[model samples]
Target: MEQIQEAYDALAIEFAASNPKSKAAYDIATKCLPGGNTRTVLFYEPFPLYTERAEGCHLWDVDGHKYVDLLGEYTAGLYGHSNPVILKAIQEALKRGLSFGSHHADEARLAQLIRDRFSGIELVRFTNSGTEATLMALAAAKIFTDRSKIMVFEGGYHGGGFLFKSGPHPVNVPHQFLMAQYNDTASVDELIAANGEDIAAIIVEPMIGSGGCIPGTPGFLAHLREKATEIGAVLIFDEVMTSRLYSGGGVQSELGITPDLTTLGKYIGGGMSFGAFGGKADIMSTYDPRATSTARKGASVPHAGTFNNNVLTMAAGSAGLENVFSPDVARTLHGRGDDLRNKLNSIAKGTILKVTGCGSIMNIRFIATPPEDIHNVRDLEGQSTLLLDMLHLYMLGQGFYMARRGFIALSLELTATELDGFLEAAQGFLRKYATLVSG
Candidate 1:
């Protein structure tokens, strides 16, 4: 442990000195923000890299060092930074107006584009972030079903909301949120059997995000859909991170499964703050003003936000999705991801490391081979977080940028050459850090 700490300390000093602007900015941010950063997601071992700019799958740090941006803003930069189409859309919208707090054609146009692709969505509503989208979806489920309980996968992270926080809650209302093992049909069945008719919804990430980028087995997801239908519970897919995997939505296009509600974010905003939730027409109609008895001219679900459906976000999101949904782009990304996965697996063959997750969204588990069959969150206990932290910092020093949690998301702009470069860097890092990693 001491040796590992020393290695990290050395790297921290090197990182700080390597970029004077980032170091200074980090120091200043610490005074106003708790951890020298606004979002905890951006925090890294030595300190986060403060970027001067980014363009087409590359990031330049404040000190002007360039790197392949594998992190991709937690999988949100599917089109890469400053994409021409998205940037132009944003600029065009700026001339019109930023917000109106009223109806906008762009909002409905974007909504139609999403509805056309996602199997589960007949209607949709916008929110500022994935957190809000998931929250609203959960609330809608509870209200529509008149049930208090929600079932969530153990390793699934829907956001940092109180209801989804780690551990059991004592309050009656939020306490109804129960956890089951991810990708484990039996465990999920057991939970549903125990709670039965009381469960309003079963929420899961089609591919786990932050809990290690693990994908759900087909059988497990299928079972969840069946169970939800059997017990009259709404099945919700939180695809904020995995939506990039498919042109039409992740689970629906990839696995041929449909959910009652789907929450989306990440790339949809085109690097801006955005989120959305949508589902079957009947369920979504619960938010319709036409069905309400309120005296107001237009009212729905008691939902209103200052920035919801802002024109800039709508325009940029439409542009981003247009590029993302192209068949050629998807094929290119998946091909690169497959190459990266195969190469990493080969390099780690003799070592105690393993890689997992679906196309484009992957993770490197350290000190153990992730189960030959990883069906649930509990299966992840076999890996070592300490080793993961060491590996993350080591790779960072070698010019790779990924989450300490081992999440990696590829962008549309990264070419085959860049993919090979990243693999070469990983191979070199693993060879040098093998001794420390073995400990």
Candidate 2:
């Protein structure tokens, strides 16, 4: 049998040849954006395909090749591209005008809709991205509690600047972050015991999204809630990605554990660039502008973002939350994705490939043996990425588009038939690569 590397290189050659237009686009983009990509995750070996258009659950690359969009814009395209409701809302807002430098009712409308959907967000504020939302959430915690230490789990991803793989990224804010092992209650417990008095917040994702879509163990998450509360530290749940797991709330709602502050983004904006952070009024009140006296005394965390309450984002978000991704739609889509993941896992039962995730998001890992569990980045890192990347190229050839990192996020626009097609492609790939991937 050929070495996996050789087979993958041959596949890459075919991919590149078939994507001449994307190649040209990349050549042009490289002069502007580094490596022809602004988002590092989209960068893959050889080159990445450039998409020309997307509608519903499909995307057409610049080379005119079309594929099912299983990446779902990294879980932010929950409404799918060109969703009629979202389009209509944005169009209506555009007719009125774009960003209003001043406050508007649209902000109140969107905020109310969010509050109605999420019980934990008593008072909310908007930002341009999830990165900003989490940045502010931690800020609120620090000011509200007057502490600086933060407890974060390894492999946990809050935002671009807030990533903690093994330790803080080079560009990560200079916060005093205490690293704990994801899904290991003891790691968190030990940190809380030592830093309880100095810790201001315990921030975590309900599931590690960028770190490979690993879900948090219920016990570990519960321990965080209890310890953070006992320590008088703010517990912030970064639900920017997992909020799509359900409409009423996210993994927290499923697990019945509430955090003091919840940061949000992605689908909440109805496919627009948007984010939010809010929770118990007291913690959020740290940014209360009405407290002019507090601001004068330097006690209030005065917040300002020119487009924080952008009129267009508010209209689209309000419509998506209230009209498109209602509780019923969320439940139905999540059920469909769950069914798809189960089928894929069953087909991969005797092979190196394994799938893990919750609801509509999941990841694939190839290993020599089935892992006991994969609750942290280190566990995922131990797996073989060779077969995983092969799976990516093979599936792309089969008209399915998933993340290069083995991540899959389904869109509500996908019908059951399209989902079934995805399953067939996976089974076929397993059969074709039996010699390489089989145990």
Candidate 3:
């Protein structure tokens, strides 16, 4: 353990020295930006690498070092960086206009595209971020049901909204949100039975994203849907990260469990910031301005944003969906993810490291058996964060980028040769780290 930590420390020093410009930038950023970074996702120990530019599946850092991108901006770049299709669309949209407070044709076009793919979505509303989309979904559910409480899975991250973040302290939450176990129907039943009447909805990520790339069991999801229907609570599927797993947003095509509402983002934005929520016609009609005149909030549910359907994002999103919707393209991306998972598992077969996930998302666990089957956030208690961090640093030093939480998202641009390189590098790292586990 000590040796591994020392090796990582040395690598950190080398990383810092190799990128003088990024190091200087980090130092300057610390003066104004807390933690020397604007977003928590970009903060890496010993400072993060500053990218000069990215093309296809590769990223060139400020130091001129190139690496095959596996992080994909936390799974937001499924089509890869600077994709020609997406780029051309964005350029065209820019020529027309950037933002229009009024509704644009592209917004409806994108919404129609999404609706066509996911069966549960009858009407869609756009938001600037997944966080806002989720917040709006929750608010709409509450208003429609006249219920204040919501049920959320422990590891499920809908967004950074106060309601979603209401767990153990430091989140400073003030709402009626209940935390339930993931993949355990009994736990959800318990919560619903205790507070079903007051609960407006149950929101969950079909595949846990930031909590680790764990997928919800089919049985568990079915149970959740049944319970939600029985109790008259909305079932919200947050497919922001898992949308890349299938052509049709995750739950619809992958799990086949339909929800009352679905929130989407990540790759749908085509490397831009965009999010959306939609649901059944009757439920979604609660927000229709034309229908609800003279009622409570004067129709429309008071959900509006200046940049809700920015032209650039809409164009990029449409182009991104074009790539994802192609059967061959979706198969290729999913194949790469499968190859990665299999290769990692083969490497760690007899070792302490355990690889777990589904389709295009995966995680590495230091323990032999991941606690609680990793169905939810509470199951993360036994995970080896220190060991994972060391392994992450090791991988970064060897020229691979991964989410700090060990999530790896593959892109359509990567070829077999690039994929093999990642597997080989990861095998080498695991072999080296196995010595520490044995000691």
Candidate 4:
């Protein structure tokens, strides 16, 4: 552990020295933006690199250092930095207008594209972000079921306000939350047995995104579906990140377990800020303003957002989905991601380094004697994050950009050669830190 700390300190010093411009930028930013960041996930010790420009799968930082970008803007940049189709669509939309303050044709077109992709989503309502989508989904569920309690996993993260890392955060919306364990049907069953009557919704991430990229076991997810039905609770699948794993429907289609509501965001907006939530017609119909009985209690749920159907997001999302990131493209990316993860595991065969995730998104962790299948974040307890921090700096020095927390999200513009380059850099890091990474 002392040796590892020594190595991490050395790497940190090197990082600080190399990215002086970014350090200066951070120093200046701290005067305005709290903690020198608007997004919490992007910050790291010393400072985070400020990208001046990006093209394809590469980023040039303020210090003029070039790197292969694997962060993918935390899965929102799936089409890469500059997709010609998306850019053209945005340009065309700009000519028409920015904010129409009314409905447009592209909004419905984009919604239709989403509905076609996910069978579970019958009616779609857009929001500015994934956070808003999840909040609205919870609201819709509570209204539809006429219950107040929401069931969530211990490590699950829906949005900023819906977080449940250890427990419901103080900043979280005051929904009566019931905590359960991810990938553990027994824990869910126990919770349902206690509060089934008051539970309005069961929200889960098919693949836990920020909570260590852990995937919910097939049986566990199926059990939730069964339990939700038995107790009359609305099942909401938060597929904000997992939707990119499959080409046709999503993780739901992949596992053949459909939920009552599915919240979506990230790449679906073609790199523009966007979100959507939809599900069973009966439940989603609660938001239908056309209903005649407005006077009746709970007849309709009013949902309004200023930029829900903004022209830029609708246009870019439609063009990217239709032309760039088609079903064939999605499938290809999934295969490549699997192959990459397999090779990564192969390279780190005897080391403490292990990777976990579904397709196109993965995370690195230094776990001694890691389990064959990581079902949840609890399975990764006591692992040293210091090793990941060291590796992050080492990879950055090797001209590769990834999240400081060891996250890597692939983009459509990233080529096989770029991936190969990343693998080689990873191999170099392992060899360089053989003493520290050895099991």
Best by lDDT: 4
Candidate 3 C-alpha lDDT tens digits along 313-355: 8888887776544756776677668777887777667766766
Sequence-dependent TM-score of model 2: 0.96
**Per-candidate local distance difference test:** 0.78, 0.85, 0.77, 0.89
Find the 10 residues in a row with the least total lDDT in model 2: 292-301
TM-score of each: 0.92, 0.96, 0.94, 0.98
TM-score of 4: 0.98
Backbone Cα, N, C clashes tallied per candidate: 1, 0, 1, 0
**Candidate 4 residue lDDT tens string, 1-439:** 8999999899999999999999999999999999999999889986899889999899999999999999898889999999889999999999998899999999999999999888688888999999999999998888878899999998899988988877789989999999999998888988888999999999999988888888888898899999999999999999998888868367987788999999999999999999999998878887889776432355577899999999999999999888887788888998888888888988998998998887888888999746466787778887889999998899999999999888888999999899999999999999998988887
**Candidate 1, TM-score vs. the true structure?**
0.92
Worst 10 residues of 3 by lDDT: 163-172
Model 4 error, position 317 (Å): 0.5
Q: In model 3, which residue pairs have backbone atoms overlapping below 3 Å?
A: 155-377
